[model samples]
Target: MSYPKDFLLNLYKTMVRIRNFEIMAEKLFLEGELPGFIHLYIGEEAIATGVIADLRKDDFITSTHRGHGHMIAKGANINRMMAELYGRTTGYCKGKGGSMHIADFSIGVLGANGVVGGGLPIAVGAGLGIKMKKTDQVVVAFFGDGASNTGAFHESLNFASIYKLPVIFVVENNKFASTATTKETTSIENISDRAVGYGIPGITIDGNDVITIYETAKEMIKRAREDGGPSLIEAKTYRIKGHFVGDPELYRDKKEVEEFWLNEPIRKFEKKLVEEKMLNETEKRKIWEDAQKEIEEAVTFAKESPVPNNEDALTDLFVNDSGYDY
Candidate 1:
């Protein structure tokens, strides 16, 4: 697929932003500067950056616990995201959602779920809403290999197919579900194989290759928008870091982690861009430097932001309050 320079530049920027943001978050969390448990999206950048790149502002996406990359890719504000991580009131969820629950409705990101496979049903519901309204908008659900075992994953796919909903189920298979490698959990060699049972088209791609992800996802996204029904795309990739900040790192071998970095998606993509003449070394450095600057600024914003006030704790519980009208 022929892509404009602007698109390529944006994709690279999004990936860089996510990588840097997660890196910064890991440091801050380790330093005890940021509150709560954190799940950094250091390795799964391409899956979100490529899949969501084709979506419009009106199109929706649901995310999992490892959702920072998805939110950043979908154009969620970095300052707000950082503030959420910092547990400040200026956050996207007013410090309530934290890392696993950031949501930006303006960009059609319903929210990120802390539960495994929580996003599948939400994406299916969004697709149902779009179908009921007769709009062409589509919904994309992002989940991990671990979540693929969930009942919601299977049930939602079946429902989407039965109702002919416009939805794309993207499984970012990083090969491990937390500590256990996928080989220890399931019998199927590929998660995409499950799609055949639901009568939906399925495709698998190298998740580390951003361009491959973009090309494969764009077709399915467009088809879903045109009412072609649901599709599942499995992206095979690896995470550079442990499940979350402070993971003991006992389950994985040290050499495996080192090799994952050697074949990291961001590093590989940068190399490809230079080889293809799409970008240069100087430009790549500048891109990374700019990303660092942006992350610093976002951190400053989140740090300066205020904490939620006591009064706000119960204010947004409902659209309207009813007390039997006295």
Candidate 2:
């Protein structure tokens, strides 16, 4: 697939933005500026950026606990996201939902679930909604390798396949489900192999390669929009960090972790772009600087934002007109 120069540059920029955002989040978390446990998407930027690039603004996406990249790639405002992390009132969820629970319905972000496989069924439901409405929009469910083992994953895929629902199950197989490696828990060599049971197309690719991810997602998304049944894409990627902030990471070797960082997707893609003469060093530097500035400004915004009022805790918590008991 031939990629336009501008499109390629934009992809690079998105990856950089995600990388820098996560880096800043990590720094803030360590400095006690941000609250809650954060599962940084430092190494998985390419998967979200590439998959979301093919999605329409109105198309729905269900995200995992490690979902900052997905939200950013889907065009969520970083300023509000930062405020949410800071537990400020100006956040996407009015500071009620932290990093793991951010949602922007205007951009079709269904919400990032804190549960391991929570988003699978939600994605299926959204797909059903789209089908019933007779819309061409599709839903993308972004989950980790650990989520594939959940009953929700199996049940949702089965349901979607039987009904020919327009949903794509994207498995961000980052090798580990928290502290446990997939090799320790999963029996199959490839998570994509499970798709055969559902009678849908399943394929595994280098999740770190943005170009490959973009092309593969484009095909599956196009197929889904054209009334094709659900598909499973297992992205074979690695998480450079521990499961969450402050994790001891004793389960994996330090040497192995260092090696993975050496081949970090963002750096690899930048090298490829420069080699292909699609991006110059000056442009790359400018991109990094711009991303850093944006993140700095977001942090400032979050810091200056007000905390949620104590009496308003239950404001948006309930759907009923009667409201909830305090």
Candidate 3:
């Protein structure tokens, strides 16, 4: 399928932004500038950028631990995301949630889940809420391959199926779950195949191809918007880094990483854009430069923003509360 020039550019920019942000976050974390366990979404940028490209401001999404890319793709503020990483009060979670639980409800992000498969059930609940309210909004639940093994994933899909809720289950199968490779843990060749048990369409595609991801997800997203039932997508990709920053990663070979790096989504997309004349060397360089600048500014904002007050922690705790408190 073909794409508009601006659409392609925007997709490219999103991927660049995610990659740049991850790189900067890694640098900061290594330099002891940020706190918490950092799960970098470096190699798998296309899945989030492509899937969330056409989502509405009202379309809800549940995120996994490796969720920064998903939030960024869904229009999260770079400054706030950086601040959250920095644990500054100006963050989306007022510096309380740190890297794993940053949320921007204004943009329909439900925040990153620290628990495996946690977002799936949340997405189902949101989908049920949408159905009850009789709205056209849909929910996209992002999870890793490891989450696919959880009871939450199975139960959430069952509920969504029984009710025909507008939810999309996206499995970012990056091969490795934490430090263990899927080859050592998973039994199936395609994780999407499990959707058959729930009576929904399941498809596995190359996660590195941004165009393929965007086109496929755009259709599924549209189908959900039109009240179609949930579908499962298994995006096959390789995790470029160890599970988190500072991970010793004794399980994999460095040569394997080098080979996968050659096939990373950003470089592949950049090549396609250049070949199609939709992007040039100058444009490509500028995209990364602008994103890096934004990252730098976000770092400054996070460093300067005040820390959250100890007593005011109870506020902003509800999804829709009338100041309910203990």
Q: Pick the candidate with the highest TM-score.
A: 2
How far out, in Å, is residue 306 in model 1?
0.9
- How do the predictions measure up, each by TM-score? 0.97, 0.98, 0.96
The digit string of per-residue lDDT tens for model 1 on 28-133 reads: 9999998888998898899999998889989999998998999999998999999999999999999888999999989999899999999899999999999999
lDDT tens digits, residue span 1-326, model 2? 26788999999999999999999999999998888999999888999999999999999999989999999999999999999999999999998999999999999999999999999999999999999999999999999999999999999999999999999999999999999999999989899999999999999999999989989999999999999879999998899999998899999999998999887889889889888889898998999999999999999999999998887686886677527764
The residue-by-residue lDDT of candidate 3 on 16-68, one tens digit each, is 99999999999999999888999999999999998998788999999999999
TM-score of 1: 0.97
State the weakest 10-residue window (summed lDDT) of model 3.
317-326
The positional error of residue 5 in candidate 1, measured at the CA in angstroms, is 2.4
Q: Residue 147 error for model 1, in Å? A: 0.9
Ranking by lDDT: 2, 3, 1
User: After superposition on all CA atoms, how large is the RMSD of candidate 3?
Assistant: 1.9
Evaluate all candidate structures by whole-model CA lDDT and list the values in order.
0.91, 0.94, 0.91
